[model samples]
Target chain A: MSSKAAQKQAAPDSPQRVLTGRQFMLGDHACAEGALAAGLDFFAGYPITPSTEVAEHLASRLPAVGGRFVQMEDELGSIAAIIGASAAGARSFTATSGPGFSLMMENIGLAAMMELPCVIVNVQRASPSTGLPTMVGQSDILQARWGSHGDYGIVAYCPSSPQECFELTIDAFNTADRYRIPVFILMDEVVGHMAERVEIPEAKDIPHVPRKGPRTAPGTGQFLPYAADADLVPPIAHAGDGYKVHMTGLTHDERGYPSLTAETHDKLVHRLVDKVRLNAADIVDFEEQDVDDADCVIVAYGCTARSATAAVTQARAEGLRCGLLRPKTIWPFPEARVRRLLEIGKVKRFIVPEINLGQMRREIERLTQLPTLRLNHAGGAMPTPNAILEIIRS
Target chain B: MSTPQPNDFSVVHPIDHLMRADRLPHILCAGCGIGTVIHAYVRAIDESGTDPDQHVCVSGIGCSGRAAGYVNVDSYHSTHGRALPFALGIAVHNPSLTVTVISGDGDLMAIGGNHFIHAARRNVNLNVICINNFNYGMTGGQVGPTTPIGAKGTTAPQGSIEHPFNLPYLAKACGASFVARWTILHVRQFTDAILRSMDKDGFCFTEVLSPCPTSFGRRNKLGEGLDEVEMYRERCHIENGAENLQDLDIDIVDHEQPITVGNFVDIERTAFHA
Candidate 1:
């Protein structure tokens, strides 16, 4: 039997409802639902801990929604397949944890060079190499930014709750489509496995951005596959569309053929890096609280932000003027808004807490250049509220 | 060299529309057999009667991998040794489209061997065309997984002691729906095999023995690409339905053994998409 037919046999027909109203769900499941709600039609992934639930949920849900789910042989193939599927004009994604993410690095570079729009949900686990498969670690934050060799920009989102897992996953897809780049949903193991009450927004209320294909028809005028529009992003034409598009990882001109020259290489690489770098003003997003009147601020993200919030609330009651600056979009680092918080809010000291050896904390220090203290924690565990509160008091 | 006179060649090339004309003259050296393999492949694609628009060509990094860029179709030049997985993505997502993976033996069999065998085991319905040139041509003719035993390469100057892979046997063992081997010298049989694999329903693989004259030939005393083609003419034998895949290893130094080539396996199975 065909895969689609088998999928139909495995699933019962239900109403085509977009939102599964208020209910308690795991962060991983919310991520899967978020992908479904965002019109995900292809999911190619390898099963791994902390992130396996995402593949499991999608495997069960995708076929019911007329989408295809392929559990590839390895993470290398999983990421490669998603790139191919996305190149074929399907909104595609994949999920992996530490070891699997390492395997995907090479192809992730390919996706960036080819400018294929796809989402990668990396449910973070403790690792230098399989350090803690079932425990939380935010160490991949740096890896997500600079893991793949070479200079290119990527958008990574951190979700602190299951609700944000659902909400931000949809946003990640939209961001990927708009930028024609691989966008990352960097979820820690705690957020991935933790269950919480998630409010699924009305389908009509949630916004989704679709990929922009070539404005002119293929075979009309010359179709330059890498020809950037005014916004520095090019329209993607899918395979089997008669576009006859040719793409490569090697540096190419606007025509998308490999042209190994200094001029072409410079132009292509600069444009790729600048697309997100120049558009940082529009792409950077974060959430701030009590910062307008605060003198001390705590910067955090992902699961650590949850602890940071409790610590901040307790510190505020203890007569400390502390607030929270939670970055929703980690890359494109949100420097302007962060600088504004320091200047406008007259913040003196900054406390950054993360579930790693100070990965994102360095970015905060570099961007703000303020007196920052890092509440660093090793992998396999998270910092406690009182632990962060102790730092806030200091 | 003087250009061919206007009347010396046909005014209108029949398969010109199927190639990226501006990118020619290609990077392959004059004696390389890769160009001929591509020629046979385009002919097979033409004869297969599938809409050209419905076909996507994918390749990994190598001299043979450049086939994807030259083809006048939606082609992706993927990372080294990852063509099968990339093609799998295209094929599995759009079952209506035919995704063909054309890459070199080293790129597919060495670094990418895991993806190749697993793809066959899953029956992904990809047209995997492996061009075996005995060494890594683009990277200066180093010994590869398919380099014949006792053959000389830059890395194996004294002579390679490693036992090379029997590609068809590997594919067959991995449960490929169809497996075949041929040389660029046998254009008719090679084209027919390519056409048959393209028309097949599951994981189909074809190994084409081509010449990398600059890399493999110069070191092994095989002369130029054309000289290797002549050697293939004298040494190659069609052994269809040969049961002993283990004995199919190529020993270039051992002239007593004939290089066996033909379709060794073909059967129907449930494809991943179908």
Candidate 2:
């Protein structure tokens, strides 16, 4: 079948090849398949609630495929080891939940500063501190953005179903490679545990972006490990490759040598922030349904977005002009598109429903500044479609 | 015009090739034992016969942390006390590379204490060298994890009531395959211990007692850098293969007992990746 036909059929079959056949699997298991499909061979993680299966599955499957799975002493080591592996020229990743994510904050910052390409999955649980281990919450949205101290940018994708979990994970790896930053896949408890049928496309058909290293051999040209080449990002050279590169968390020049001057600090930090900020248009992605000609627009993501779909469908049938907007990528917040929606004046207001106490709602309100009502909950349970529909009617 | 002949000083130095020439005149204080340890480390690398290209050095934040930056190899200047975990990552990924972590006592035992014990317990195939100066020398001599009880520091102006860690004891108890302790004065012994541990297949640890003249030494009346080294020569004793690392704590307050120094533990264990 042609490429267009494969997409048009929306069936499990594709023309070129079928990577993995359709199967009934849990969201966590599908996540492992996505990693395997993306050439992931190194997994270092500490198991936590709603996310342990992802690690458990990879632990057994990775070795057969010539990959390595290491259950580190703790979350800190998990993040550290993967960063080390990534620096050593291997595609690596790790998965964790609430407390584990918190423990990974410092090293996550190190990953960002070193410009290492790696992926982290936050199967979020409710928290102020380990609130509900087995339940879902999207409270980590802001934490995912600014959790690490210092000025830098990160890319995050939120998936609502097991299928999206499989697809977005591959994209997460590609994006991490393209930008040389730590990419996050923020999955809550429900989506991580829920079982569904997922069709993985053929490996060749899936997109892959490998980390770019120096084209010039080490010592031939003046190679600056941190030097940006037009894209505001530098190519990474692995150790033992004779690059003889030195990586440090401190502010440094492109030569990867520590330069503690104020001028050098300004130049390095601005580039780190701009690499993501300027490329926001390319990184932002979302799904909009019946958005135009609607009086009320409901913005949701992850597990809550799935429920919002039903609520919006019922509202439309009841003769209410309501639509649903689900974000596929949440970190480089789809600001331009959402701002355009608010500008057109078709939608009167927006309702933001989340498992947590209105975390992303604040960002939506901040961006649009329109009449935004927050449908909030403290988490352990998903908000019912009826509860959301009642808000749309009011 | 012809290039001038290389200086005699550079030719005789054991670590001249290992040093990052551009980064010479390191940031170490004149009497600081860090440079001495670096000399000993490079000598060990040469003696062990490991290719310098195949070795990676990782260090945490402190005066000692600067050691990684000055080494002519793939090195990582990790965040405070995070050298061990980061080095473990590099070692486990590339088993062909010999990974070493060099950091200070405050860095390895205080902020990074959990990682220290856990890395040993797991018995990862990495060599760790800790420079114990008894206080946080880089941050104006604050009290730290290895600060002896009733010792004076900026943070412990009233005299620290906290007891310091017996690092060799800690490493042995935490399951290190090889453990040893030596002062800066015992350069040959320290270098030999590092060379010996290089062949070990599991976690290996060595603690070097170095002087911090500017911060730790001045306040404690240990004299200048040379005075501190002289004190070590007088107070230190060798007790190789001695059991019970627990009783080997440095007693600064009483000043009566000799400071024990030597290889304390050497036993084989299964490596983590193996």
Candidate 3:
């Protein structure tokens, strides 16, 4: 019954599609390659600076592998298309920048509410409104966490280098599938544009996570599309799979019907949030360096983490007790690790350096309630190692 | 409440197999035409002889958007003004599924207008059923892009001075492979139109001119739902293959003006791909 187009399954990672070897590649290109490796079946995107390469590269690469890529009318359509594809049981995604990211927020919330699995790559540029479209910014850190209007939990990853961009994008798709929610690769313009070594492993070696499907057989007349098990995640039934699943953006019950009661809303929303919140230990990932005995911890992510790592090294050479803590998963913000660092009573202060004025620093301050200083940059440029060192010295 | 025994309900609805009968007592008000349109849609699905499991219905937010929920298919009720792109995603990803987008006028031609034209222009293979009740019925009959000029709405209490779109012409101009319009009163034709659209390969559109008696009808002095159907019977004329689609604009304010309804455009076009 499948149409000719539908019969063309996303080709297994071929040598032509997957550049399986160590090679210098742009962060955006590496992100696309990573999606290809992760068995991406569909991608919809709009052209925005720092993120356009991700789309442009995928446009050519996806077709080669029999996967589909669509340049949608706008960011709104791009995100909407990916959500639809995801609901249809395709491993789908979309890439955008700050302004486009803002346009995608409403649909992102829908994906969260519907518990659809899709990846979103926000190659963030400086912005409130089209600020430094071609330059770097980490200001969207908070936006990634709170841009979509709602209380649902989301997963976001901040990759500091091209290699991490490739690696974390796969993780983003896996996490999205695991939780049946939208996962974000919150990349900055520097990381998106910078060229660095990306080690692409063989397709078999790359870890991939397929979507969970209902154990209930088709035509059983017993499948409840939104009935979650102990993990609070319902197995998704793809459209046209004879499951007759009805999914909606409205608050729904276990049957996926619009149950607009306060009780159903409360239960549905709490499950949406708890799925990730309870699994925070497994979802949250970070790298801590030289923090066994340090008085100051420099917390950072994305491109700024590179500068923080340099600053930590310089502080150590200069006989100062400073360390670096970089969060790979930004949302589910490594609170436990930061709290543990604080409880040890060794880390007295935190200095967060980023391209943004102060986004992640606010999280650190809010969580630890300690003296936290920010090495601020209003984007278009990254803070130098010396600038971060000055904050650590202070 | 106790579950009724099988013997207690001897008579089953003819289209019950294709409907979420459990979700009945639908949200539609008395005299609304959305129910009729959904009926024709489900009837067409039954007559199509295709696997019911291979059908997917998607709807954006509005009165007509509820069609997705009521349809006993793998369906999705997406956000407002996004059903076209969402359906496009499904259609493009898995063309095996006969995806249909059922939405209201404001949901399709207003906020979702961009997606509508682009999807048509790309010739995406999906069926679109746009229920045009002249105003935003769910939002208390506010003025919308399809509300005829000089028509009264909640937002335009005096009259809607803005121009409304001629939906059939818009769809045709946007390169739809098949374009048709029918009032809900034309139940048989409407069902056949939907069935015909399901057979087309590229983008196909069927605009359903429905009545929102509670919200739009009362405000515009269009009387009850039956009165609106009577009006359609009086004014509507089937004109298939009519030339100069530009003249097919609907004028509710002037009862003397004719409402042209027919399968206006049907031609082969290459469906969009990656």
Best by DockQ, which number?
3
Q: What tens-digit string does per-residue lDDT give for candidate 3 at A1-394?
A: 3456645564576676678898899999999988988888899999999899999999999978888999999999999999999989889989999999999999999999999999999998887799999989888888888888878889999999999989999999999999999999999999999999999888788887777888979999888988898988889899888999999999998889999999999988899999999999999999999988999998889999998889899999999999988899999899999889878999888888878778888888788878888788898999999998888877
Worst 10 residues of 2 chain A by lDDT: A8-17
Q: Give all candidates' CA lDDT scores.
A: 0.87, 0.86, 0.91
lDDT of 3 at A190: 90
Q: Which CAPRI category fits model 1? A: medium
Fnat score for model 3: 0.87
Q: List candidate 3 segments past 4 Å from native.
A: A1-7, B1-10
Q: Can you list the residue pairs that collide in candidate 1? A: none
Tens-digit lDDT string for candidate 1 (B37-152): 87887877788888888889999999999998898889999999899988988887787788889999988999999999899999888989899999999999899999888898
The model with the greater lDDT, 1 or 3, is 3
Worst 10 residues of 2 chain B by lDDT: B6-15
- Identify the runs in model 1 with alpha carbons over 4 angstroms from their true place: A1-17, B1-12
Candidate 1, overall lDDT? Answer: 0.87
Candidate achieving higher TM-score, 1 or 2:
1
How many backbone clashes can be found in candidate 2? 1
lDDT digits (tens) for residues B77-155 of candidate 3:
9999999999989999888789999999999999999999999999999999999999998889899999999999989
User: lDDT of model 1 at residue A13?
Assistant: 23
Docking class of 2: acceptable
* Predicted structure 3: lDDT: 0.91
Candidate 1 residue A17 Cα shift, in angstroms, is 6.6
Per-residue lDDT tens digits of candidate 2, residues B67-110?
A: 88888778888888778878877776667778889999999999
